[model samples]
Target chain A: AQSVTQLDSQVPVFEEAPVELRCNYSSSVSVYLFWYVQYPNQGLQLLLKYLSGSTLVKGINGFEAEFNKSQTSFHLRKPSVHISDTAEYFCAVTLKGGGNKLTFGTGTQLKVEL
Target chain B: GAGVSQSPSNKVTEKGKDVELRCDPISGHTALYWYRQSLGQGLEFLIYFQGNSAPDKSGLPSDRFSAERTGGSVSTLTIQRTQQEDSAVYLCASSHNSYGVEQYFGPGTRLTVT
Candidate 1:
């Protein structure tokens, strides 16, 4: 079985400040990692994914994540954030060849303070 | 392009009643998935359908939850004997395939059990 854990339930950062949302996973087999964003009363939208090759993965809206095998983590980062970046972010993982099913985390709420 | 769509954005039902949620996947997509989202718990996979094949129901929390995809384009999730614990936002998503594809999500139906 595969599982995903998000370390912080919420992270507050000033607008234009750097932010990092941590995510960890537990799985013995090969896996794929993904990040999603959810705004107020909206559905989740794909942010980024790490399938293979490059460890640093860039996503939409100036977000990125790094897949670290040694650390067993896929932490999302943003060099600079805007007020509109405040949202709930989810980290997910799935066993290789598991198709499209995802094991999601409890989510990290990015609260952008003006 | 049109994205995945779900019907009945909100639902209020009495305990013991059955409710059915609908999903219309993106055209030409071959995989559809159902998930649950609540206040604390992020997103939990409920079921997944691939083309016309049997669905993967391993993630379903209970037998009360069941889903079906017809004509390979749409899906319906039926919750039997609605319990207060079943209250959550039911989300529907679709992807081209399971091979690490990004799943597009719908607005989700918020089900409230009374």
Candidate 2:
């Protein structure tokens, strides 16, 4: 079975500061990785995904993540964050050739302060 | 275009009662999925439906949980004899038929079993 682990349960940062949310996964087979953000009272929105090709994948709102095959980690990063970036971020994984059902990590709440 | 939509954004029901959550996927999406988000469990896949294929019920927690997709568009997740443990946000997502496509999520239905 595949699983995702997010080491940080909550991350606090000041506005305009850099942020990184770490994610690790355990899967014997190859997998696809994704990052999603859920704002208050809203559905989750896809931040970025690492399917194939480049290890460095950039996503919306100036966020990005790197898929490190060696460490089995896909960490989300943003050079600078805004107060609007405050939300719960989730890392997910699914088998490459298997079904599309996603295995999600315990989300990391990003609280951006002024 | 409109994104995935879920009905009854919030539901309050008593224990032992039954509840139904609805999900309307984006038009032309061939895959739909149901997931549950709770403080204890984070996020977990519950069921999956793809075009004409057998729905994957492997992720369902128990027999009391069931889901069905009609006309390959709308889906309903039925929880019978709900318990306090069933109080959580039920999220729905949809994706295109192609491999490695992103799954768009809906604003989840928050269920509170008293």
Candidate 3:
């Protein structure tokens, strides 16, 4: 069984400020990690993914995440945010060779305030 | 090129009634997935279908939830005897046959059971 945990339920940051959303996962086997964002009344969009190559993966909208295998963490970060960045962020994981059935975190709501 | 699309953007049904939600995957995608997103409850995997192999229903909450993919393209998720708890957004995603691919998502169908 695999599971993902997002420590923060909501993160409120001012415009132009940096932000980081924490995520951790527990899996018996190797896994692939991903970050997705959902705007109000819209479906989720892929932010970034860590398949196997480098630990630091850059994503759309100035977002990036580093895969820390030893710590079992894949935290999303952004240098600065805008009001448009206000959305729900989700961290997900899937087994390496088992199947693509992703296990997602509870989600972290990113509220960008002016 | 059209992305994954879901029909009946919103559905309101009475409790104990059965409802069906539809999903049309990308034209060449061979992997499809169904997920449920409830208020504050992030994304929960419901089922997964990959290239004609037996579907992995491990994530389905209960027997009341069932899904079928016709011709490995379009999918229908049926909920029998819907409950208020079943009210949520049902999301569909599809991806290429390769492993660890990013899955494209649809807007999702919001179901309100009263």
Candidate 4:
């Protein structure tokens, strides 16, 4: 069995400020990690994923995340955030079992103020 | 649909009413997923369909919620005796069964139960 945990429910930052959204997961086996962003009244958009190889992953909109195996963390980071970056972000995981089952974090809302 | 498409885009119903939401996945995509996002919440997995095989519905909240796929092309999710708690944005996504590929999401159906 596996589970996903989002450490923060909301994050607020001024424009151009750096921001980070924390996520963690626990699994008994190998897993795939994903980050998705949802704008107001819109659907989720893929931000980035950590399937294999690179631990430091880059995504759209100048966002990035680092997968820490030891910490069981996949935290998203942005060096400089903009007001348009305000949205709800989700973290998800998929394992080999459960027939491609995906487990999602509760969610973290990012608010970037100008 | 060139992308994952879900309808009706918005639905308003009273408690105890039954509602059916539909989804059309991307062409040739072998994997389809349904998720729901409540206000100020993250995405919750509901079910998954792959090819013509039986769906993985382990994430279904209860027996009152059910879904089906037809001709391996489209899907319909039915919620019986809808409750106010069922009001949320239902999202659908599709991707090839291949690994390392990201899922493409639909705009989603917003259901408001009065």
> Model 3, A9-111: lDDT tens per residue?
9999999999999999999999999999999999989999999888999999999999999999999999999999999999999898888877899999999
Candidate 4 ranges beyond 4 A from true positions: B39-41
lDDT, candidate 2, A1-114, per-residue tens: 899999999999999999999999999999999999999989899999999999999999999999999999999999999999999999999898898888999999999999
Local lDDT at B29 for model 4:
88
User: Which tens-of-lDDT digit does each residue in B1-114 have in candidate 1?
Assistant: 999899999999999999999999999999999999977566898999998788999889999988888899889999999999999999999998758889999999999999
> Is candidate 2 or 4 superior in TM-score?
2
Candidate 3: CAPRI quality band: high
lDDT per residue, candidate 1, A26-62, as tens digits?
A: 9989999999999988999999999999999999999
Worst 10 residues of 3 chain B by lDDT: B37-46
i-RMSD values for every candidate model: 0.9, 0.8, 0.8, 2.0
What local lDDT score does residue B1 receive in model 4, on the 0 to 100 scale?
Answer: 44
Q: Rank by DockQ, highest first.
A: 1, 2, 3, 4
Q: Candidate order by TM-score, highest to lowest? A: 2, 1, 3, 4
Candidate 1 local accuracy as lDDT? 0.93
Model 4: per-residue lDDT, tens digit, B1-114? Answer: 478889999999999999999999998989888988886555778998988888888888889999998888898999999999999999998888866568888999999999
Better model by lDDT: candidate 1 vs candidate 2: 2
lDDT of 4 at B71: 84
Q: Write the per-residue lDDT of candidate 2 for residues B1-114, one digit (tens) a residue.
A: 999999999999999999999999999999999999999998999999999999999989999999999999999999999999999999999999866789999999999999
Top-DockQ candidate index:
1
Clashes of each: 0, 0, 0, 0
For B18-97, candidate 3 gives per-residue lDDT tens digits of 99999999999999999999975668999999999999998899899999999979999999999999999999999998
